[model samples]
Target: MNSWLEVLKPEEIEEIHAASLEVLEDVGVEFQLEEARAAFQAHGARVAGSRVYIPRLLIEQALTAAPERFLLEARNPARSVWIGGGETVFAPPAGCVYVQATGTARRSAVPADYIDLVRLVHQSTHYGTNGGGIVIPEGDFGSDEEKFAWLLLAGHWYSDKPQMGLNLGAKVSRLALDFSRMAFGGRPGCRILGTINPDSPLMFSPEMLASLLIYAREGQGLIVAPCSMAIATSPATLAGTLVVNNAEILAGLTLAQLVRPGTPVVYGNTSTIADMKTMAIALGAPELSLLVLGTAQMARRYRLPSRAGGSLTDAKEPDMQAGLESMLSLLSTVAGGVSIVMHAGGILDSFLTLSYEKLIIDEDTGGMAKRFQRGIEVNRETLALEAIADRGAGGNFLDHEHTLKHFRNEIWRPQLSDREVYQEGRDYQAYTLAKATQAWQKRLEGYSRPVLPEEVEREMLDFYHQRFGSEPVLDV
Candidate 1:
């Protein structure tokens, strides 16, 4: 792999790490869960009510205990993905309650839309793992439990790829593990990947800590992410925000290690600058990429897999703004060597809406980014000295055997981009929208839901009925 993109110098990284340690040792982090506070107190941390001042020794121990990488297994073994070890895995977007299609008004996503989005990820050539909470459906289930059940069940039924776990709380986390075991059958290894976000400004909510502890004790992969909006949840300056972000993540990592040593933990950062006017986190800002770069550097320093960046945009539509912003963030992610890329596709309108057209467009963008990450292979074969000799100056090699043999793998062909000469017709944006719409429609039409065992499907259906007491939403 090419050299990673670095925003922080080596000395600057040490300064940030030292500052974060100081913050953890002084200001400390608040843990709302009693269990978390007790664990910290037992582990030589100073516990004051809900706040725990973690010592540098504890942080070092946790960093040493956490594994650098792990494997996430899928029902279909071929679809399994490696979470770390210099791997860059693209997962779909999560937590979007609204969805938009080309030429359609933004509105609450329904059950059918969720199913369709799952199918899109299942058919995608770029996305690897089907991230949980792909969309929070409206009027679909009666409660969070029912909604989570549908999301997990439909994700399994529609896609056999590796999946991330639901981190809503303890109940949902347990539900994810139970469902995974029902499908994969008493697996000893990690079958689900999960991410827990610490509430910004150095705080961990009870529900998040509960999920973190549950996942850690169960030996599931956990990502401790802190989304600190600069000047809002964290300090105004980017460097100050990094200090806060690192401290919160370190606290969570130490807690995970206390619960279960050698747990797979990814240092995650979704921090960015807040829109000065609205005070909302701006996903499209260039500073977002800088934070991802800095976060990756910090994760490398700790020798852990890092998760950050995505095909992010704040555009209301999949237009020029969306394209530019998404590409900028995604390219930075791949260049920075983020191991697990969250929100890689389908997000829009400051992550409030998931656009179907943008899903297809971002797939192409991700493909391009991964291709760029691969860089150039300059071996004997690729050197093409023999081809140059075979085809003298001014000679054509288009029909050569070497050209025919390597073109497909050597060239990154785009699925959505039109490379032909332009013609007078609809505008570029209109053309792109039409193409993306057709692409998703084709994928849905051609999609075949992955088949599950009869016993497993029946067991899941029984559990659904017993738990939710409602008919399962199995339509795709």
Candidate 2:
């Protein structure tokens, strides 16, 4: 395993842990659902109204019970990813309502756009899973259920990689699971991942709890993330924000363990300070690097897999601002040793929209980060003193065996980025944009549908009707 980079010392993590425990025992966390409240009360916690005062002992127990690493079983077992053990996995942009496509203004995405994005992700070399990659709320389907069913069919049909499950609360979540079952011939596997986010300011909504319980009971991979906004929901200071974020993660992880011990739940967070003047969430601020590094330390303390940060930016388009900010966030994430990174591509405008050009650029960014994570090998073969001795001083080793054998693995390359020098006083930005646009079109037009068996495809459609009741038939 590659060595992990750290920003906080042991004492700092301890201080954060102690402060988080104090917050849990004093201020308490609110659970809107009766079942979640009851579960907390049943365990050793005191309940007052919707708030639950959890003791430090209960948190320690949950941390002890949770596994350090687990397999997210894929339909193709070879593609399965192991989360934890200093390993990192990445996914594309997910749950965004709008897309800023090439040569067009921002608009609500449709089904075809969603499918094309999935195909692109399936073809990308960098991403390990297509985790809830697109969120097209206003699709061609009549109902949300119908739209979701078709989306699942398309994702499962286009990619054999592991994927993310939907977050449509409890009742609708079942439809996605059933569809996945049909996709893989009724196998009870944990390929689909789900997320449980606490409504910030120490609260978890009823709908969030319902989905958490459903996904936990169904034996799926769960990400316990809290979207904490500093100075608005959390405290103004970064350390203070960590206390609030850690508490939410602990509460969610405890709930998952209580539902079913040994369940694969990831310790996750996306907390950042809000802009003081405008009060908007600052997703691309430089301070986010610290948050990502802190999340890694806390996850290590609990011995659970962690996730955060990505090719993220607050820029409106794929420009230089987007490039700098996304790289800053991404390098921090990779260095922090996050197990699974969400929104690692295509996110823009503080995550309100996705951009196709940015997606391509982010894939390239992820490739660079992955290569960095490999670190440098220092064995005798890599040392190559023999080759050095054979070549002598002032002699070029470009034709030597050592250089020939190692160059490919030793050097990094780019796909979307260009190496040609632009003439002075030329419009380089336009050239970049035009190149990205051409690349995006080339990939989408060249995509071919994967071979999902006829029986399986038919079963998938039948399963949709068997679950959705056929009121809104899919047009695709």
Query: Best-fitting candidate, measured by lDDT?
Result: 1
Instruction: Report the lDDT tens digits of candidate 2 across residue range 60-114.
Output: 8888888898887666778888888888888887888898876799998776677
Q: What lDDT score goes with residue 99 in model 1? A: 93
Winning candidate number (TM-score): 1
Candidate 2 structure lDDT: 0.83
Model 1 per-residue lDDT tens digits across residues 331-433:
9999999999989988899889999988888988999998898889888998888999999899898998889989998899988898889898758878888
Model 1, position 367, has a per-residue lDDT of 90
